[model samples]
Target: GESVGLHLPTLSVQEGDNSIINCAYSNSASDYFIWYKQESGKGPQFIIDIRSNMDKRQGQRVTVLLNKTVKHLSLQIAATQPGDSAVYFCAENMRGAGSYQLTFGKGTKLSVIP
Candidate 1:
């Protein structure tokens, strides 16, 4: 149930503004979270990550906030740009039964209008 599919394929944004992308995760036991950015027709690249033990994690131009109590996560982009336009995916990793696997939430499309 953690698998994600976008309702829209594209999002247009102005070049110099902040962007917030949303994703919904299914597993309540997931302990690790990661955010990835994927450009048009490209593989997803790691943006940032947060563990269940922490509530927030930040990167150079990005920040990931996790609310384990509600099973919610969010990614914030400082400045929007044409190069920043891409699809964003949130993934969760659950550790149990002596094994771990990543479950990806449906992605949101981000488009920056330059």
Candidate 2:
């Protein structure tokens, strides 16, 4: 079963350094995953995502890794910047024919230190 606040925390990084964010999900049946970045008072912005069929996926300056064995996922950011400081979140969605909803994990707030 998917619920809320599985483990949303915070992550801090220095400017120009690489950052790694992690998430653990409860639904093994979930096949779709997405990562989002939410700044203060702003809507969430899509970062990256991965499917159950793939173990790893990458985007511009970002990487997503999935470990179904442990039901864990991780996000890697290359050269973290001050603008990257925000609350990072992970969302999981199950595969179905009908309508489906997203189960968002606890957000990790990344504080970029200059």
Candidate 3:
């Protein structure tokens, strides 16, 4: 089955350091990708997104990169902070017959060590 998965299940970063999370998707047809952050007891919040037509997109303190050639995606965080500790997920949106189907990755837990 087509799915999205992360290269690592957990990532630990020291405070003020930079962190990178990698994800791989099986569906090459997916045209849209999104990165989400989920804090404890909270729902996933949108972080950044990238379209297949482009290779990269940047947000406030984060950047998302897409490599359609290998069906790979990545999220980078600058100056990691305690508040940045959360479960990060990558989602791929594929267009179906009449609607879009969203598939989420298993998620990578980001631990910020102070």
Candidate 4:
């Protein structure tokens, strides 16, 4: 069995500060990794993706770093904002024999103290 958990249920930060969201993944054999941002009542939006072959990837205002040795992952946001307050989840894609499925972490809630 595999699972993901957040170290904290909620994080409060100032509007101009940077934010780091952490996730713990259970399955090390997973090939693809994705970070998603979910706004209230909305579907998760793709933030960035990285393959097992790569250690890090970056996108507009966001960066994702993966550490395979420790089975850990993290998301970095450049500037915190009120709009950036939301729940973020990490998903791992398990690929085998042409089959794939995404397993999502529980998620961490970000709260901006604007």
TM-score of each: 0.87, 0.88, 0.91, 0.89
Task: Tell me which residue pairs clash in candidate 4.
Answer: none
Give model 1's TM-score versus the native structure.
0.87
RMSD of each: 4.2, 5.0, 5.0, 4.9
Candidate 4, residues 24-44: lDDT per residue as tens digits? 888889988999988777788
Best by TM-score: 3
User: Distance (Å) between predicted and true CA of 100, model 2?
Assistant: 1.1
Q: Which ten residues in a row have the lowest lDDT in candidate 4?
A: 1-10
Superior by lDDT: candidate 1 or candidate 2: 2
Stretches of model 1 off by over 4 angstroms after superposition: 1-10
Sort by lDDT, top down from the best: 3, 2, 4, 1
In candidate 3 the C-alpha lDDT for residue 52 amounts to 92
lDDT of 3 at 111: 89
Preferred candidate (TM-score higher): 1 or 3: 3
The digit string of per-residue lDDT tens for model 3 on 27-62 reads: 998999999998877888999988899999989989
Which candidate should be chosen as best, given lDDT against the real structure?
3
